[model samples]
Target chain A: MIPNLTLAVVAGVLFATGVYLLLARSITRALLGIVLLSNGANVLLLVAAGPAGEAAFYGRTPESDMSDPLPQAMVLTAIVITLGMTAFILAMAHRSWQLSQTDIVADDVEDLRLVELAVRDVAPHDEERPDVDDDAAGDDRPPGPGTDAVVEP
Target chain B: MTGIDWDILVPLPVVLALAGAGVAVVVTGRIRLQRAVSVVTLSLVLVVALALLVGADREGPLSVTVGGWPARMGVVLIVDRLAALMLVVSATVTLGVLLYSIGQGAASTDEERADEQAPLPIFHPTMLVLSAGVSNTFITGDLFNLYVGFEILLASSFVLLTLGGSAPRIRAGISYVVVSLLASVILLSAIAMLYAATGTVNMAQMAERLDALPEGTRLVLQLMLLVAFAVKAAVFPMFGWLPDSYPTAPAPVTAVFAGLLTKVGVYSIMRTQTLLFPGDQLTELLMWAALATMLVGILGAVAQDDIKRMLSFTLVSHIGFMLFGVAVGTAAGISAAIFYVAHHITVQTTLFLVIGLIERYGGTTSLTRLGGLAKLAPVLAVLFFLPAMNLAGIPPFSGFLGKAGLLQAGAEQATWLAYLLIAGSVLTSLLTLYAIARVWSRAFWQPPIEPATEGLERVPRGMTLPAAALVAVGLAITVVAGPLFAVTDRAAADMLERAPYIDAVFPGGVP
Candidate 1:
């Protein structure tokens, strides 16, 4: 059985490595850091429980019995969840890269300015306005009438 | 023998699984079929949930031993009134959101096929999975099961968060994923420590064992658990990821996520504080955290010009009110928290749906770009009014009633801590009103810009119906405040009196 202190030490090393990866600039590396941190935490959980025999993914043996099952179950759930999240984050990175040809976050100011410029630069309906004017002229109102009312005139 | 047996809870998970299967079929490539199935399944789930609540309301703690194993050895699904009532509320809001989503699609004629790389194909199934996970979290009698449930919902949320793969969304998703992962690890480690010390993972069993552990060990376990759940709940300092991530999701997704997800975290916190470590020490830490979260959330809301982002910040801020109830560690406070959570979910989701409607009509969510919507869509204006007031906790609304209950409880204790909570609630309410007024003045009251009007006035029928329906729901709750508060009061009582829960799981009592 490993000493509790030694197990904790190993877990601490894992956590340090995980934290370093988490602080990296790359999104992918950061995700890896999350994975490592979770595993480290899992190890810490095991250490907290005390010495346990090695347990295979599917086995009924002394090795499995020696380890705490609850943390193991939690670890399994965390692993599955991490897998889904990592995949989603990678997909996002790919999309962001596609949109801007860069993986780093882009500023929205340029996009906003472009939209403003487009609104200001173009007249959307010049031809249509003259058509509306010609149509209005064919209506039944008397042209250049000076009277306030027809009866008064 | 003549009464309802309190030993039957596992079947609720089965019903949820069935609902998920129905949703899976709908989302697997059939758009029309998906809408039908989603609505029908949601309605059925809601009905069953209500039945569970009423049946379990007066009954003692209801537990179902899974796979015929004893409670100590096997997984147990317990349905106390609190769990059952939360299930019903979750189902109700999910139904409302689903209807709104379908209505929006129909209005836009986008019902046939979503835009290129549009994410509805995957969204519906994941939402069902998310619902199932939530139900499991409430029902399970064990801590490990709760951890597993959190993972299930969190995984689904990753897809839901970045559904469209927009640039901002991607950036937001990265932070959200990392933070949630860290919390999960911390939670797992805590679970490990508990099992090691107690040789059991069942929450009921752990509560019994926890009392016997050394004070230092117990405090460490408690702190670790609180930190983990707090991160999930988006409590004050740990809430950085929520505002950025939530605003980037599609409107319906945002509404549902806003309504239920963090509340689950708060629910867990309530359970942990009450069950595992029932004392004053943790409440002090929680009380301060609640005040900070309340203050920080509203202040952030006031600063945002984007409608969705502002709502997300408020979502974080209001969590403090619920936490305040739990921090008081009294029956009245917990009950108030229950009531507050129920009301907040409806009000928050409705407000988000209204924002979606504004975007549909005004062509942008930016306050600077939006104006004079009331003249164009009076219905939309009316819809926005109810939830906005409700969120600000104005009189005659569920929000006010819930806040009043929380305040009353705080006053009963009347400590400096309670005073801080009261002051924070009042301040948060005022700031919330200010935020809502900003939205109103910018989006509804001012004259419309000619530039903003071209190609922007067209609101699809699909979208309008959902927005209108959500508004109606907000008003309905306001009208029916009496029944809702009664339900909340009952739920709060059930949670505080722990005997029903403990007795249900271990009929033969603890060893």
Candidate 2:
């Protein structure tokens, strides 16, 4: 069986750790979690191709013992996809840091406003006068609590 | 067997799109050239897709095996009535959005074209790539290729979603990327399991093998695939990322995203259910999920202040209508769902494009800030009103007909869950009308409290004409509904009788 259990155990631990980090507030931690998850997924794919076989090539082995090359090819493509995804996330994280000096995804003000409206039971039709005054220029600030100021002072 | 009939059309759309992307890339800085290349490419795609649709309609299902690799091995491009109709709808919607973006001067203007990604502007190339990926997703017959098609579109979308790298867009992009990756991971895992158990990923082959698996194993694989597709479809519980993600995008990007992306997932669910797993084991579960998606999505819409967020929520909700039909597991129900999917794609994109114009004409989309648009821009009022009513399933419109079909089919089933969906569908339709009417009264009918600074933006013909054109597409669906419904009827018939599809793709048969 070529230690199928060992790879399965490793995948489980990776998923557990990955899920833990994915929930963290920090963007970098989330990025790390995505990486771990991708790796675990790749391993799981390999495991799915059967536990033992020789390399899949023309002269490597009999057809029965030949490792299925399709899973390996699929995993390679997946690795490439994860690489591209990682790059995009890194760019987003960099941009986040550039704008806000932090990599955490801050709460969206509009979502917060909607939530607050629900909490306060303010009808959307009657939300104009006082609501705008309170949030848009509450004591004359650039943004309300939920909104973040990009570009550090 | 069919004398090389559909094979030629099979690769042309994706090939043309990829080539267009290449040209757009080389001439990145020349906005004028980019516009010409983009429009010509998509228009060509639209024409070909329509021909394919008509040909498939006349000829029944059409399929071609790639690289001559034989059945169950080659990547097949199938043009069944279902896939062909979806192709035509997606092509029309994409072409409409492409023109809208160009006419909106979204890509042409130097100011808007400000590159945050690289030295050269990427919007044109990325959009071309995105359209190609969408076409590929619709055509691909095998399981793994479908995943590849999704990856192509998702990669393109990441660049599009965070176009400006502005704070809100980047934040939205993060969630979109994460949720999309999560879906991909789950789909990949399920595919691996499917391959392991059945030893094949060609869907027609799997159909033969799947029924033989132990019930537990079969259910697990089916749920894994459903969950993955549901996440893509933005079904209720998994739809958390949609509202947050879509609203922050630019007008045209958001329009295409809202219109096309979730529907692809819905189509996948329908295809898989009818083809591979032809039973009603999960019918109740899907019906309940469908009901929740409708009520919760519309409720979320009503609660929103902004037009885009509200539209996004409704997008999620109407997906429920499609699922309701599919879950009924009958020919009428399936046809109704197919018709609704086609109708929703056009109407949703048109509404989003109209909102873009509303934002242009009125200076803001927030109902609070916008008012008196009925007088200010009557054409804009007409543009918004028609689709809004159509989307609400008002009489004589395609949306109404589609919903009526679903309701009639649900009534025939006589299950309590079916009745629940019927009530939920009607209630949701009325609520959609209310939600949209609220937008109309607030944004167009009533006098503005401060009179939104409209004259500042100088609403151009470029943007308005495209919105008008898309509205016309929505209307065309109504006029052609008799024939269109017949087509979907045939598609439903084809799907339920899987022999033609499996035989067409696999020649002799899967066995």
Against the true structure, whose lDDT is highest? 2
Docking class of 2: medium
Off by over 4 Å in 2: A1-3, A109-111, A114-153, B106-110, B113-119, B452-456
- lDDT of each residue in B1-511, candidate 1, tens digit only: 1234434434654465556656575567877877777677777778777777877776645778788888887888887777887888888888888887777766664543354126547666777778788888888888988988888888778778877676667767777877888888888878877877788888888888999999999999999999999999999889988887888787888999999889999989988888888888878888999999999999989988899989999999999999999999888888889878878888898889888888777778998888888988888898888889989989988788889999999999989879978988999999999999999998899987555466676766766676677666666777877776776677666666666677777877986
Provide the TM-score of the second chain in candidate 1. 0.95
Deviating ranges (above 4 Å) for candidate 1? A1-3, A53-74, A100-153, B1-10, B13-19, B22-27, B109-120
Candidate 1: give the clashing pairs: B6-B62, B103-B462, B104-B462, B104-B463, B107-B461, B107-B462
lDDT of 1: 0.78
| Clash count, one per candidate | 6, 0
Tens digit of per-residue lDDT, candidate 2, span B44-147: 99988988888888777778778888766677888788988888898888888888887776534566556434456788899999998888888888898899
- The DockQ of predicted model 2 stands at 0.52
Candidate 2 TM-score to native:
0.93
- After best superposition, candidate 1 residue B109: deviation in angstroms? 5.2
* TM-score list, all predictions: 0.87, 0.93
Q: Model 2 residue B86 lDDT?
A: 87
Candidate 2: what lDDT?
0.86
iRMSD in angstroms, per model: 3.7, 1.3
Fnat score for model 2: 0.62
